[model samples]
Target: MDIANQAALVTGGASGLGAATARRLAAAGANVAILDRDAAQAKRMAGEIDGLAYACDVADAASAEQAVAQAAAAQGPARILVNCAGIGPAARIVGREGPMPLADFEAVIRINLIGTFNLLRLAAAAMIATEPQGPDGERGVIINTASVAAYEGQIGQAAYAASKGGIVALTIQAARELAARGVRVMTIAPGIMATPMLLGLPEQVQQSLGDSVPFPKRLGHPQEYADLVVSILTNPLLNGETIRLDGALRMPPR
Candidate 1:
């Protein structure tokens, strides 16, 4: 679907990959809404991009519902929904502190997996109510962020990997269910990116991580991820699949 003049809601749009996607969509003439738990950062980013900023905790049903309503009220129902809000807390089932708290695992699942589904369901419902945009009867497109951990999780990534694996599984099935309604679902399993989480590390640490990549030997830029998102939104036939954005890096077992 053409992003021009259409509405888009990007969760975790305050920084990192989501921020890059929001800017790209805005540059493409879409009315964008930046959704994130960081109100200040969201507002700042929204101001810079000339878009709406919504403080939202995607993990909460009520919060997500209200944010979506507010966004729709501002720019009409969003036809493009990008689920980039997620947390990656590395922890083993049994850690140095003994067995990991069950709540810790649940927390990751709540934010990464359930939160993704919550926004997808709400956004798809809104998109379904809108008129088809093209000859293909396309109403909307959805892009979700998963992780390479889902496939090759390291030593302390059980919770993170499980949450992302769930996201990967949800992609094709959700796409099949939404196909009849002219909505598309796709997932991106990013290996390693120079996001805020990574940038915060020491330069040596960052370099070490970059060297882990097979060919590029560097972390992916947020813009790289954003570009793929643009491609996914424009390509009518790309749906119901999880695309890995890694640079041929399968990740080592930590």
Candidate 2:
């Protein structure tokens, strides 16, 4: 699917990975729409990229539905949907504070896992209805963001890891189900990327984290993730797979 001029939707596009992706897609000639909870930031990014912006809470069915509909109204139905909006506050299931609040765990699951599914289902339905493109009759592509923590969750990442794990598990199943509709589903499980949250740490701490990577010895760039998204969109054969953009880093259980 040559996404040039095609409608694309990116959640959490205000900053970090999603912002990078929006810029990359726009640069590649895609008509991009950014959906985020931060209305002001979303507006700012949209203005920068000349794309549409919608205030959306990805976890809410009504909010996501309204935002997707509005985006389609402005830019046509989205043929490219990327789920990048998520949270990752670390907490132990049982700690000195006693078992982590059930609400905390539920919140992560809601915002990360269920939120991803909300947008995915809406976007996939819209994609399925759109006229297929290219010789393969491809209708659309969806790329989701997960984390290496899903595979090797550390001591205090129970909620965050479980949320990402759900996304990882959903990848193949979604791909298999959407394949017949000419929709491809894939996932990127990043490791220690230089996202804003990570970059906010002290310099020495950041350096130490980067040094843990097996090679390159640096944090993954958000642009790299965007590049992979472009690769997945253009390649016809890649589907039902989760690619780790971790530079060969298999995390230890901290």
For candidate 1, write residues 147-229 as lDDT tens digits.
99989989999999999999999999999999999999999999899999999999999999999899799999999999999
The global C-alpha lDDT for each of the candidates, from Candidate 1 onward, is: 0.96, 0.95
TM-score of each: 0.99, 0.99
Name the regions of candidate 1 deviating beyond 4 angstroms.
none
lDDT of 1 at 139: 97
Model 2, global lDDT: 0.95
**1-254 in candidate 2: lDDT tens per residue?**
89799999999999999999999999999999999999999999999999999999999999999999999999899999999999999888899989999999999999999999999999999999999999999999999999999899999999999999999999999999999999999999999988899999999999999999999899999999999999999999999999999989988989
Steric collisions counted per model: 0, 0
Candidate 2 off by > 4 Å: none
| Model 1 clashes, total count | 0
Q: Tell me how candidate 1 scores on lDDT.
A: 0.96
Q: Give the clashing residue pairs of candidate 1, or none.
A: none
